[model samples]
Target: MKKLSNTVLATACCYSSLVAAQTTNLNEILVTASRTAQSVDETLASVTLITRKDIERSQAITVADILQKTPGVMITNRGGIGKSSSIFLRGTSSKNSLIVIDGIRVGSATLGQVSVEELNLSQIERIEIVRGPRSSLYGSDAAGGVIQIFTRRGAGRLTPSFTISAGSDGTSLAEVGLQGGDQNRWFNVTASGITTDGFDAKTTGNIDDDGYHNQGLHLRLGQRFDGGHELEGFFSITDSESEYDDFSSDRSDTLTKVMGASGTFAVSDMWLVNVSAGRSWNKTKAFSGSAFKSRHETVRDSFTIQNDLLISDDNQLIFGLDYINDQIDTNNAYVVTDRNNWAGFAQYQLTLGKSDLQFSARVDDNEQFGSYTTGGIAWGIPLNNNLKLVTSYGTAFKAPSFNDLYYPSDAYGGGNADLVPEESDTFELSLRGKYQDVNWQASLYQTTFKDMIAWAPSPTVLYPYRWLPSNINSARIRGLELSADYQWQQWLLSGNLSFLDPEVRSGANKGNRLARRADRILNLNLDRNFGALTLGATLHAEGRRYTSDSNTSSLEGFGTVDLRATYQLAPAWQVRAKLSNLLDKQYQTISGYNQAGSTALFTLAYQPQ
Candidate 1:
């Protein structure tokens, strides 16, 4: 199908043939990039789990609106849905993506990258996407994949909840929550707030915010002893203020503050341990001219440990280790710099016979780009009883940020500390099937990148470090992903299709077409359940994209439709309504930026006995 110009985003395609009609109790299905508690067909990669009743039956409020309806994911919004979003998996880039919450690492290492529009899913409770190249278990932006988000904890009994919402332009939202605990101990707490007034700024907009304000707070705690041994603790805080219109001429403002903490332990029966730390403090103020002002700060810390040994009954062994540290401070409307980093890692997983295999490798050494190594392999097969086959290969590396290495602006564009670190090699293949109520999946992918950094010109400066950043030996990308889900008895239907082909296989912008990527994307979802009433509808299609970097104007191709309804007036109470985009479909997948035509939301809930 020869067509690639970016477009390989993963996160969609789930339903392991309902693992043969789930007998339930898969350890209650909860995973944070594999800490343990297997079963999602016993994981070997390609994972997607979204719950909270699939985020309130797809009322999706952020995290790029539930990753644009999951499935071999692809999202390109430059406006609305929490504004500015970018992600691409199989096809990579978005600064080689990697995001985590709960397990920390909420992106942005000095705007190095990671923006799903600053996450907000009303304190997410579930979301796990790990498609490929996990940087051998997470090390360099996971080399193009990894999206974990697990909030809400505590289950059964004790409860408290609250919600508020308002629609259209001046949008508004509020939330409050509390969970329960009993056998052992558990806790879940949440607080949220949002405000928006944006829209109408045309001229290939990038945001002159008609308005913006955000707030967040969360906590989760758990403990258990008396044999099973376990402990957990987590915390989060976020704040934001926004208004800016990326390209040239006029208004500005951006402010952010973030905080995080994490802890996890399980000392017996196949050891497991985790530790996390985070901090993000950002400030970008500009009121008039002098081509955009600047101010920055960043701090990060990480640690991880793992195990799952059992060498018989069809082999089982998994091992792990990790560490990360980063610190940055900047002020470069002129000059000011301080950068720091350190990394360490290891991984492996194996299980044979019925099929299950995995291997991860990692290495990160950077005092300023030096030392690199990353590895991957995955295989899962069981081609009978309903078909199944999977394959994977990987390698990843990235380094070059801090405004791409020091910033100085004339309307955003500066940084080049002799940039380096940007490498990749990825491959994938898949096929899955299930009869009975229909369920299917298909996948194919390819990625190749070498020293593919960005920004360049320096041959001895002249009007912008002569514009320099370097590294672009070659580039290549390919993709295909298809998904299907069908269920009876209560009706459930799903669909997803994506295709991309990226290029720039050499120098001088080799073959062009790779900025703000998009080759083709599609999504469809429908759900219905007569009795307690649950109805849903969704459709999003995008294709046609290009935003300079030498791809030329062009950002058309559009389609949007959404409608939702939920009712469960008893046993805890619930009532929900939503209408987004409806027939208002205006377009722009990225190129100047313009999207978000219609919107609406409503909700009510209660539970107590």
Candidate 2:
């Protein structure tokens, strides 16, 4: 059957190539990384793109799964889908990475990081990742990298989709979605539910009988006036109940909801205004016989206004201001805290000689941490028609979280109000060249951090015997990345390689590598297009890494391969089959957890005209 299918697909491709011509201009892409609509190649940064086809082939369920495919990114997963997870970029600590949703920062103010597991992949249109510091464009917590997620926007008329799947771990999931409404007004809505008896807990030596269940609903609505003005609103609500294997692994049932609205208006031919506002609420409750307990309520609200002005034929200026208010009510051993923040930022772009230069600056004021300023500069110079050299330098800062400032401690918890914010300076340079049918890019960067905060054992006369948040004098990180893509008449080959070195330069951690950071990572992708059928394969390699701050525990890295193929069953429907971890390599990416091996996934997609 396989040989027959291959021959048929090849024959169809030959026929199509003889009758149709393909154009490269039709492949142009638009992105919002610089807060503007620009072609992908025009952006002067180290960017990685994950397309819808990639997502379908991977069969990912959450944002983390997709992010892990990008070069220079490492993800730590505690268990199955929807479990606790954190992301690291170029050997930077997990908290150093920032997550943005629809251009807004959504990371928890107290945890110092957001749960990427909380984001569903079903509604995402695309994900754009900019590696390295971007504090010049975004503010604090942009040290490691910037991840932006773009949700589905209605295209034409009302369209809907549904999917159901059951997997190895006794996992079952169902999802339904609807989108579209003409060209001027449209809306997209998605709802999903999942339940699992769960795979066995390797540690406890038996199947996790407790299992878990989760349900979520999401909606996005947009309207455009006849005159070219637009308004958009989005909301997401989720609830979950799950069980833990033991006291150490226990977790609380959670309920989370978020609602937001944004709009854009064309004030004149050369000026445009954009505004946005939103709110979020999170609640968690612990079950009986649980060692970890918390009944916390968090509410976040913010607003932003931006104005774009055309200074001249070669100059453009964008000025913006924003305000945020956060409130937390918790009855845990970790203390309660409240914080309000306000910020204003401005960015300017100019065409200078044979180069394009971008300047940006911002200042943020926190009620508890006072105020700080951030700034950055980006320069891009064309070496020729097919090559460009880009470089950028910026400063970023991260304020202390509620848990960092005020947690209670008998043995396992505590707080430090006197804690200061962390700051870092970053510099990066890169070259991108596109010639004929081949395109390639390479980049190098370094970052230096001051007043790095970490939980350290009390020295001499501290009250807590175990740990306390203290400032480390300095930390240093450096990395190099190379990516290339070659396209032939019927075959495409792409690969990326990254190397990172992160170390503690001062304090008790001097010479120790940062925790959960992989020193090297590599990925390669191959695709062969045969008319309405395409065959693809991917290989990933990860290097050994440490799992603890003390560097006492380690995990040996491993390699995995994935194979997939898509067949156009009909004009409107396509079927795909994928085999993940093709070699069935059994290895632990994390210290105490085992990754799934040799799994198969199949998907069917339909498009109606």
Candidate 3:
């Protein structure tokens, strides 16, 4: 099956190659790839930008819905809205990739995973995904890549917007916001709420309606002074409650909050300096019936100081310092609850004779894990006016999460303090280009990991057969990615394909496929615009997957389709509708979990012109 899918994708790529409908311009100013702004086509990396227009066009309720399959990304959900979800970027573990929001890292300290499901699209302005090792630019948890989310910002004259919607499964949504900006200052404030009586999440053993509710706010203000100086500040929060089936509890309540401020100053014509600080909080409380079960909370404080300098007409340099502190507050006592990490990084960019080159390095020192260094190099050569060739190599590592090192001993298992961090090396090459209205890319890459952490039995006096986390695995992964975007007349065609081979290199399960990593993923989007009305469709397919290292249990391959439409009533009013899972497919990406059957939603909006 995998071979057949690969062959089909290869044939499609040779037919013209692709990325997406809105990406052919090559004019996007990307900031996540190199920690500095550059045109998307000029960066020597695999990157995707999802704009506000794209978000509204998709009519997606959750953030993960917008990132299902874009090159090297794969998403799995335990169930529906507000359920636990995982994003396997580059076929790496959930904890291997990093998630950033408005310059602040937000996630559970214990699990080291981001809750992408809880992130709705109403307050989001855009999303940027960089697929490759980014530890050289950001300190930790960037072995696979980095995903950055930017919230709504003010621009132009004062404007007000609101949206109300209803959907299947008793789902509902409401949002309101006011935004405005001039040359000197800007401000934006938004509030949103959503609720859904979801479907049963477990295939068997437990039959119940799992429901979820969430409310959130986003507030931002920014000021620009003379001499190319600026300052910005933002605050955002989400509170949610969800129901699911579990042995210890059946309900989960969570609160996620973030606040931050940043400033940019130009000291000289050739140099610029920036400063920023932020705090994020994540807390989860479990409940069954009316009885409270447990609680886990995480707080993160971060600060940064960076300087950008233009050495000459063809050369630029960037250097920065970062400070991060993670502290935990939980019901269960552990050995240690807090840790700090200090990092310094430098990057150099050169544009010489139509060729681009970038070099980056970073050093991080953690309170518990001592120090580590990583580096990367990238080059882009223009083969002609219509094509370009790019190559890159990088190294990255992931530190153990709090649960892996400090969880107290229990009856079945416990944490291990004497564990080493996992390390990885990646090499990539690609051919990318644009021709008039068509943009396409074909990329191939491989990554090798050492000292990967895993759970295994370790005999001891107190707990003879306790399973504890240890650095006991290694893996080798190879992948191919094909993406393309084309716009012709009134129709837009865009899509991407992901092929992954994540293998366990050294373990009792050696030669087995990496647990839960699917080998083939295909996504496509087709849209047509007719006057004031627009119509579109999305198709997503994935290959089979295993549930554990032993590969005994497996889940079959599946596919889904979504249909959407939008009609413009006026310049300031519009209506939208989406029929999700249009095929009414019954499939599960996660073992033993049940997926939502079908859902439909209709929305009306009052947006500013």
Q: What is the lDDT of candidate 3?
A: 0.85
**Model 3 misplacement above 4 A:** 1-24, 411-413, 455-468
Give the per-residue lDDT digits (tens) of candidate 2, residues 1-609: 001112222222221111111222212343344665444576666777776556765567667867886777878765556666778887666677777666566756666667676776776766778787766566667777788776666666778777676665666677788877765677778888877665443454345544668888888777777554778888887888766553334555878777778777767656667788888776767665555556766777778888767566557677898777777777765454667888888888777777888788989887877888988889998888888899999888877777788776556446787779999988999998887888888999998989887775563344434667877788888889888888789897888888988888886679888667788888888888899998988888888887755687788888999888888888767777778789998776656555667767666666553
Name the better of 2 and 3 by lDDT: 3
The superposed Cα distance between candidate 2 and the true structure at residue 29, in angstroms, equals: 5.0
Give me the candidate number with maximum TM-score: 3
TM-score of each: 0.31, 0.89, 0.94
Query: Which candidate would rank higher by lDDT, 1 or 2?
Result: 2
Leading candidate by lDDT = 3
Which candidate, 1 or 3, would have the higher TM-score against the true structure? 3
Error of 2 at 202 (Å): 5.3
**Clashes per candidate, residues 3 or more apart or on different chains:** 14, 3, 8
Sorted by lDDT (best first), the order is 3, 2, 1
For all candidates in order, the CA lDDT equals 0.66, 0.71, 0.85
Which sections of candidate 2 miss by over 4 Å? Answer: 1-32, 201-212, 246-249, 288-292, 333-336, 456-468
